[model samples]
Target: MYKGYFGLKESPFSIAPNPRFLFMSERHKEALAHLSYGLGETGGFALLTGEVGTGKTTISRRLMEQLPENTQAAFILNPTLSSQELLATICDELKIRYRKTGATLKTLTDKIYEKLNKNHQAKLNTLLIIDEAQHLAPEVLEQLRLLTNLETDTKKLLQVILIGQPELKQLLQRRDLRQLAQRITARYHLLPLTKGEVGHYIQHRLSVAQCDRMLFERAAVAEIHRISQGIPRIINLLCERSLTNAYCSNNALVTKKIVLLSAQEALGDEYQATFWWQHKAVKALAASAVFAVIVSSSYFLGQLYGENISEKSALNITAPAVNQVVSDTSSPAIIVADNEKIPDENAAKAITDNTAKVFKIESDGDKKRAVEQRIVKTDKPASIPMPVENSAEQLSNLADSKLAEDKATSKVKEKLSVKAVDGVSDDLLALFQSAIDDTEQDPQFKNSANQVVTPEVNAPALSDMPAWVQSDLPSLSFEQHIYTSEGESWVKVNGRDRYQGDTISEELVLNYIYAQKVILTFKGQQFSLPALSSW
Candidate 1:
């Protein structure tokens, strides 16, 4: 519902593991790098462990998509089966044909070895990736270790990658699994994103959805981050429900109220405290109230002047003295009132006087300097004659005060600007303006620039377009030049490439670009399938 209202092409906050929406934080990137190392020419077992929903699976899928042309990969998502069943699954994934009726362990091992050797001879490397390996029995794990032993003098014939939750680390710590653990050449544990990363993660998803970044309020983002603890899966869950609540209400943008409702519903009773405490607006209000009280009280005590107040009356309020001043001979002395029958206000003023006395009393070098400055300033009465030839001093004081006032005003303006721009964008604001105009206009035929353009193109508009355009056509923007088959082809993005390719169509070039960039995932699995690129 909100997608239509907000002009989003898809639900950006869906909880499903969609590779297209994967965003690898710094920690997730390190995990990917470790897995990639294992899959490289220098080969061995690569171990990755993390909490559930931390994106290991997505990372694994991304790595699979990035595998070289001469590399074959098999993924086993479940590893809890018996040794024979596990072996059979691996064989199936590897496309190794074997008679199942009398398939003994020895026979299966031989077949796997034969297949690996054949692949090796064919100049191809094979990678076996096992997920949820924490559930693998010791026997099954031992068998997996044995597979790694199949090797030539040059390098191992097979590369194995094991991924699982943190429990997998404990599982590996078992004495029986020591040998297996020692064989792991590369290991990394994917950590949940930091609080700062959670904000970026939300924006990344919103950008992918093509929605207004302001879809989530600042308070809502904080609530989601606190409750999710920066875990990608949890963030997905909270964001999805929050969006759904907004959708049901037909609201284009998510607000703090909607987030609260969604949190109460989706997180149940577990995250009540976090949901409340992490609200940014609530925090700001609390801080503001505290600051207001402090400033008001400090101002009331630090400055005083009145029309009909006697010295005794002046001494009755908690206001600083206008005439009494400190001297250089002052020590750290406690002030005592001679009259115990003083008025209540006067008693309060005495307390303030005690504080001032304490301020004047110097106990050390820095304190002495500060106290001297205070004495010098407070000693001058407002009625005192202006010193001869002191105009420059007065001007300097005025300039400093004005500069302070300017800085404070600038800070307030900056804060207001930041709040306004928090998650808002020009495009979104224009779209909202157009929506309001359409609402006001009867015909709803507003031809504003904010209108969403349909993806389909009219054939007439492309009548002059060439069939075999140059690879570097103005319409195509790609880093490198590449060639593709005559039929439709897609660009595959990986990473930044300074080099260029030649003789490529726009569509093929796009596919290459997409393929080169890796998608984010959980536990090395692709979080979302990529959208098919337009040809």
Candidate 2:
């Protein structure tokens, strides 16, 4: 309804988990890094704990997006079944076939071991990630612990990642579960967005939704942070409601008053309107008619910045029932699109808002071009023309003959009587001369005759810059180490070579490791790091 008014392609504040709208704060990045390391590193269990809607599932999808080709990962969203059933789920996820459907626990374990062993033999790493794992019974948890027992002399064969809410930490604290807790090698807690992060989160989603205009001002974001307590899910709910109210009221911006109205609609009658009315400071707002705005604003502001603490009784449980199939193995090999998005309520709303559902919206020329450009995947290389030696040569000769004829006719009619240099045709001379001045004046040109005629590099070729010059990066002196911080001495790049052993400097190592040269190594076997510099 307000598409034309605010000039948004879609509703920006929907609460859905669209990967395109994912704004990784410092904390979220750390959490993702921990999870990535846990799976990549050959070690014991990796545990991830976060409150409900704190983006655990989102992180899981992101991890899947980043997982290496050789690493076979099974994400179990529900783990409430018996030990045998759990084993079956893992097998199903890994697509490993087992003969015995009614196999005993020991027999099932043996099958899983055999499958994992086979996979390892094939040079494939298996990672079992169990989400919402707090609901796993003590026996089931112990069963998982037993699975990690299979190992080679150097490192463990099966790596497991257990993710759940904070209650998972509490559950692990039990005396009986202490043994399970001891094996966790890497652990990270995912916290809610900070006040600043909340504001960013809102804007990030809005921009992603194709909105250029600011829907929420600074004051409104602060109000949202207070009410939602910086929880992404709550923030989403409030924002969605606010947008709905704004759309209905024909408001261009989601003002502080609008956010409060949305909050009251979401929070219900328990919140005191009189409390806001009594507060002289809040009542002095420019918008007076929206009475609930002042009261709810104060109430939530108190909640923000630790003025009011959330209930400790609010337990976060990883119910086996929270089953979401984040990745479908059958889905086009699950390409993580440069602009790919995970289905979230926010994205869903954006879709609905942009489509001919709520309003009849017509796109302009730029909008149509933007949409067309998005359809083109520039990140991916152009398709290779299949090799046909005979056909290629014949076509090339035909083109050359035609070019020669055109040049001969042009030379006969041209004003310049000079013959084409070195059998180069007049067309070729004109084409080269058109841009010759630019290259002649280039400062990088060593000498006119010795000018480096660099091969026309494609996007894919230029993308390998870092990998080519990785070894050339400045190295740190031995004494300069000073143990700034402990980082993984080795990283498994593209699962081909494990760059292990401590570098004199982590920064220097990382800079080289993430270079385009190194990244292009994984682009395909068509090109490798060694061949990158030769170009």
Candidate 3:
């Protein structure tokens, strides 16, 4: 709208990347130099990427224009094609003829190869330039790579240049695409223009459009840079809108105010609402929200941490039994009591809650033993006299039983005291004498000195059996079981006692006294014989 008013031949700020209106900022020159050098060195591939409208496409076109007269270039404007479609498109771009009815990817590729060979024979280089190359699929890009492989030892048949947004660089970096990426040989990321370049950039375009004087104020150029962030496409859009607004008002030069208003209408909706974050109220609101999230997270985390504690608190026993267990000083009760001080307040609160279930102890005995077994194992003082008790009537019954026991003991002593008789074995005499002498001799055991005791072994060992055994087994003329320094039990026989002096039998030995039998060994093996009958 303002081109005529500003003495311009046409719209200078059109977003289309026209060659006549091209402005090569310093970075653009470096990028072009890098990519051109790459294509010159190897006929493989070159990569040029940039933000939207940073002039990647325009610069690539410039590269094509700069190619030698012997070079034939194929430009692909839209790369969003399948492998077969892309191969056909490449053939079309190179003017390589193929049967359109049966053009498979292989057929199209073969035609391209023939063209490349023909170009090589004629001393012409083939270059394929794909704009917006980021949209090319992995398989399609792979197909392009295969075309580059049709080469002689000196150079690739196809010198490919890939131009796209920054995402093209990312796409090439894929694990599947690294082979193609490595062949690129050279790559450059075109950045947006600097704030200072925006002024010169505007004047260069104005000059191309036949404008002799500066049509935009200095402040307006700065505003343009701010609104567009130096992106070429957005800069052109804002400058165009600003020019229209200025023309509507019949203003001579586009001002900063015009650029600002134009940008408000152009980019307002897509822009994020972040300015409010600087306000005190909004900052406070965000802080509160963060605090709430943290608190909620901690609460759930605490519950997860307390799962073990809750499991330990669950007891298998009934409530009354659990209360009884708590009275004991074992580790489980103490650990449950100490859970109140856990660092996680919520966890601790749950564990120490009054209504929480009580848990059984972790001790192996606790898991396996019956209640009675556990009670008997304890060192506690109090216990029920459930099985046995002391009383006057009970004492009388015990006294009668005691009297019968004494008469029986007396009869055993008398019988055991018999002298050797004809036909009676001499071995019986020593064993009988040992039994007679083992009767209690101490005043403490005198009232019931008739308890029968076994003499341990041959002669001397009989006195070394046990000290308590000596109290009931009084010292007699014959060998007897008696206390001694050695730990082994010993017994005497009339035949062996006279010769073998108090030596214990280290091997299995037995002595049968009528129906009462005794087994003894030096290894401390003892046998409890059943009660002898009164007969």
Candidate 4:
């Protein structure tokens, strides 16, 4: 259909075995050389094997064309026959007469030997080429090997060429066929075309079809090679479909897009569907792993630095008192004078706050101690008169309170020193430093300075609030939500359906769709739009 449209005399990519369209790659040339050498030498068996559609038959055809005029070749296109039937077919190919009704194995063999002997005397070589030799039965193959045994000391009477797929190689390796395998003097395995050769192959076929100009783009040729895996038959199928599609679309040249579509058509729905799902699964798994790593790292850094900051704040508030006690044990009078200068209620509250910040205390016992300390330190004695019997109790309580205060201060100093030492450890310090550096270098942190740091599970729903929450952005309205059912999710933005992971515009893109939320990037800002449904 497209031959005239593309200015071609014939279909360039027909799967038919045409010698004019054959592209002799390096491997093909080497395979021919092996076959030629095997036939020239006094050989028992010559072997040529390759994968399906790798030009094995083309090589065989070329070999036949180059045979010497003195050679009498018998081609067997089918090898599914009994030993006697095979010999009868050979006799028929050689024009040897035999009884049609009562042709037994002995009769066929004697006739073949007589024919071979006659050919030998006439200085004519007998070559038997069996196509699809892999399907030959063990007994039939053994019988054929036995025929080769009827040779003179100088040369074999019969030369056989076995050509088939890669299975033929395995077939020859059986223990039962070891004797026959030892007689194989020459063998060559043909490989598929290289990437560079695929281009030349297409061009060669196009030239044979009488087209002068290049019809396929370079990238299209590359895509063909990639999809077809350099197999000639598959390449032919894809190129043929691609050209047909281009011709139908009225395209002047075949492009990569056309080739892709053509491949999907030619390779069938099962392959395309399987490849599509596998690609998606791999991408999703990789994305999930990266997300997990980032989230885990961020959470760890937050916890580590949060504790460091809280401890630093506590140290700043209590460092002066700790230093005062450590510097002078004889300055107890000076400490008491400093304590008395502050108002009783204010001093007690400061002490209680410091203790609460350091120890996270929740008991009423600690608060009662603060109140008693305040009462004893108050300057106005006339405003709060004490009973005569409780005055001695107050004195004893004051002494006990003083001892407790000293012990508590010493404990706080010890804890602070220990924490300071721990904070300066090599591993801990390195961890804290790395966390700080990562935060400073993070691209998201630089872009959104005031962005809230929250866990994924605690992400807020978009629909529960107004479209634009800030009062400054009352006019800007862009609403998007996710709808999920049966394990798939879709994004709907302002009444327009958008596929996930595709860019809506230059400034807006649907990044991902989770079960509970859809992540989007709008004008350099990322938003996690929650799903309207529960799941």
Candidate 5:
């Protein structure tokens, strides 16, 4: 199709065994010389083996052209036949006719021997060339060996040439066929063309097709050789496909890119994997990227959720000092005071009213100071003497003392209010109050206070937990799972000591178990717990 466009007389890369287009390299020349030498002698057998499409038949045809005029050649294209059929076919090829129907093996062999003898008497060389001889049965090959035994005193009358793929060489190595192998006087294996020969081969064919200009670029030829692996048939296929592609694109000269595209089209999957990134390198890069993303995401999540907080920071906040008093001392003091005092309902009501007054103080500093003073005054040693006075007198005296203390506190507040106009002690008090308010409102301070005031034996406060821990994270944790040989499934949930059934809790139940994942229903919601391979 591309001949006229490329100034060629015909397609250069046709796979037909055309002698005019044969470009014999050194290997091909050597192979031809070997075959010629084998055929020249009165040989029992000459063997020629090559890989598929290495031009074994081409060399054989060339050998035929170089043979003398007295040569009688009988070609057997297919060797897949029984002993009788093979002999009959050989007789038919050599014009040694026999009974058309019901021909016994002996009858066919006798006819072939008669022809061989007649050819020898005429002083003519009789040649039997079997193509694809690898398919010949062992018994049929043995029969051929027996036919070779029909020899004269000087040399064998019938000459046999076996040309086939490399497997034919292996076939000859069989123990039963060792005798036949011993008779093979000459054997030659044909190898594919070399890289340099591939370029010369294309030019030779193009020249034979009557083209003068170079059609394939230098790099393009190298690429063709690489893709074809110096195999002539594969090179022809790739070059033809590349030429057609260049023709389709109206390209004047074929480039390496064109050759690459042709290889992908002609070779398909065999060449698809030739790309540098399609195999281990790309997979390794992708795996590295995935691992990096996972590690970075894990670190970011730990920081955001405070999961990476140091143990020292948590312990520092939780440890209490010896002199630090908690604000909830009123409960214990009231409980102790109530146990000690067995007074009437009126005195108890008076005490309760004073306690409520003390609690109602809004300023934390003033309240703390007042409570400390009251505790100090009321807390006397057990050995201290009690005042000898009536319960009403004692309660009245206590009430009178509380009223005097309140009046004194009011006077001090009034003095501070007057000092506010002067902006002396009042500003200091305001600054102190602001500092106290800020400390109380500070989250860190509150967290530390909560940790210190609460005993470690009690359950932790949920509010103090990290945000991600308190958030709606996946409820189920897959510690481990096992499947028995009989296919019974069991799993440990949340690293619990015992194995739970499919139903773990009233609200959570196992739904399905897979090799890499476990499904569960948590509070009527379905979720998946992925199996962690490592920490």
Candidate 6:
């Protein structure tokens, strides 16, 4: 269709086995020489094989043209016939008459042998060529071998040449076919074109078609080499498609871009990545896809685990030195827990509300000075009531017993450890309880043993937690959760450790568990964080 527009006498890239357009390369010449040696002088059998679309038939055609004028050739395109059918086909090819009905294998073979003898007597070389010889049954090939066995003192009466794909060589390797394999005098296997020859091949075809100009760019030629892998048939296909593309666009020549688009159109998506994977855009696209998946997956998992806090859901309360519950104000407050305490409340962590009074105590000449400051970060207000008399001394005493407080922290954590793991750490609890004994006796403290609770955990959100979560969250005591990788629920909380099902004291009001490092408030004043001095 594009021949007229491209100044070509015919389509340059037609895949037809037209001998007129054959461009014999060194490989083809070598294969031709091998077939000539086997079949030219005195042939019993000559074998030629190649990969599909590698031009095995083209070489065979050239071989036929080079044969002597006295040669009588019978060519069979399909070799799938049975022994009797094969003999019948040979008789038909040489115009030998046979019985129309009830023809036996012996009857057909005798007729073919008579024809060969007559041709031999007349000084005519009888040649038999079979295409797709790989599909020939063993018995059929054996029958042909037997026919060629009828020889004169000098040469065989019948000369045979087999043209097929690579499987023909493998078929000859069978032990059952050893006699036929040994009788074959010459074999040639044709491979694909090389990169340099590919360019020459294209130019040869175009020149044969009478196109005088350079049709494919140098880069386009390189791309065709890479895509077609030097296979003549595939090269013809890609080139034809590329030319059609150029014709459609009314371009005088083919470019790398046009060839690429043609490859995509002809080969589809399977070949798209094959070429572009070496380019930077493909790598960048792959990297961007991975990053997007990681970010999206993290967010999705967080929605399932509720481990990290987003700004929309909770305030930014920095990781703190210690977890102190403020109960003096009506509003409840929680301060982020840390391994150690920092004297600077601003850098350490934020207090819940503006009215939450934080008293800072530092070593004085001989006494401790208590400096009062209001630090607020959330709408909820959590205040700690202080005794007006010797307030700094009371806090000083609390500060003095650091080892004791750590012990108490550990003790409370054990009693509250997810009991669902089905065990408790008694020794650690005893040690921690002993540590907090002195601070628990301070008169300013109003917390009863039953009033303490931790925030909600292991759920998508605090507001969505079960009713039991509020009561079961860790209390004034320290809390440690043992997470397992097995079973339906991995979190082991106190109690039967059923998810969100822990039991707390009746005196304590169970509220939604809030894990905000900063202050968080529910419907009313129910949460509070006591300053370290107050604790």
lDDT of each: 0.63, 0.61, 0.65, 0.70, 0.68, 0.67
Score candidate 5 by TM-score against the native. 0.52
Write the residue-wise lDDT of candidate 3 on 366-450 in tens digits: 3643121011112232332211223466679989997987776676556545566998788656655554464344221221223
Listed in order, each prediction's TM-score against the native is 0.52, 0.51, 0.51, 0.57, 0.52, 0.53
Greater TM-score among 4 and 6 belongs to 4
Off by over 4 Å in 3: 271-535
Show where candidate 6 strays beyond 4 Å.
268-272, 278-535
User: What C-alpha root-mean-square deviation, in Å, does candidate 1 show against the real structure?
Assistant: 22.5
RMSD list, candidates in order: 22.5, 37.2, 42.8, 23.5, 30.4, 27.2
Writing each residue's lDDT as its tens digit, candidate 4 over 444-472 gives: 32212333222332334434434543222
Worst 10 residues of 2 by lDDT: 479-488
* Shift in Å, residue 500, candidate 5: 57
- Off-target runs (Cα >4 Å) in candidate 5 are 277-535
Clash pairs, model 5 backbone: none
* Pairwise lDDT winner, candidates 1 and 5: 5
Better of 2 and 3 by lDDT: 3
Question: Backbone clashes in each candidate structure, one number apiece?
Answer: 44, 11, 11, 0, 0, 22
lDDT of 3 at 155: 85
Deviation from native of the Cα of residue 59 in model 2, angstroms: 1.2
User: What is the number of residue pairs that collide in model 4?
Assistant: 0
lDDT of 1 by residue, 1-535 (tens): 6677667899887766677888978787888888888776667789998777888888888888888899988899888899999889989999999998989999999999999999999999999999998899989999999988988876888999999976677688899989988888899977667656888898899899986556787878876765675678888878888887888888767787887788778878776554455454476457556756887776576443222233435445333334444444545432223322222221112234323322333358555432311212233223422332355786799899978756764543343231235578786455434433333242211223233221111111212334433222333222222221221122322212211121233322221111112122222222112322111
